[model samples]
Target: MKKYILKPGRHQFAPSSPAVHINDTLTDTEAKWYLQRFPHIAKLFIPLPTEGEVSTAKKSKMKSNQTEMEQTSAFAPPSGGKAGQ
Candidate 1:
């Protein structure tokens, strides 16, 4: 499977930035779309965002799981709703 490492927001694609970093694994269609949208995207390279990789990725997953757990817990009553009233 191919993996992409984008800068994570609209601000990262600012015009003043020299080139938008991209992963080499991208298919032709993906590359073409990025290039068309951001003309200055110079090169496709291997393994982007080496710094803070684990923390950044894990943080997203943690938040998502936390939210899901909270929602599920809210729907499920404690101890399956005791014996009766």
Candidate 2:
């Protein structure tokens, strides 16, 4: 069964279910059942990523940010110019 990580805060999957706190692990079936019963908290259930997956995602994000920075800098006006002068 896949695992999911719950976001920070207390949550009750059901009226009879025990409350769960931040960083709690939930099985795939449990998460699906919880969502079906409490759709409002859908954002709170995050799929647990593997170690390699997390690192790869971080690298991709960093590369994307760097590319955006480069593009932004390319269009920036020369620093010496005074505004409305």
lDDT (C-alpha, whole model) for all candidates: 0.58, 0.74
* Full-model lDDT, candidate 2: 0.74
Worst 10 residues of 2 by lDDT: 20-29
TM-score for each of the candidates:
0.37, 0.46
TM-score of 1: 0.37
Residue-level lDDT of model 2, residues 21-69, one tens digit each, is 3554656677777778888777776756779998999999999999999
Q: How high a TM-score does candidate 2 get?
A: 0.46
Give the CA lDDT, 0 to 100, for residue 79 in model 2: 98
> What does candidate 1's lDDT look like per residue over 1-85, in tens digits?
4444444332233367744444444455675576679665533323455569878988999999999999998877678586344
Candidate 1, residue 20: CA error in Å? 31
**Which model scores highest in lDDT?**
2
Pairs in clash, predicted candidate 1: none
Which ranges of candidate 1 are over 4 A from the true structure? Answer: 1-49, 82-85
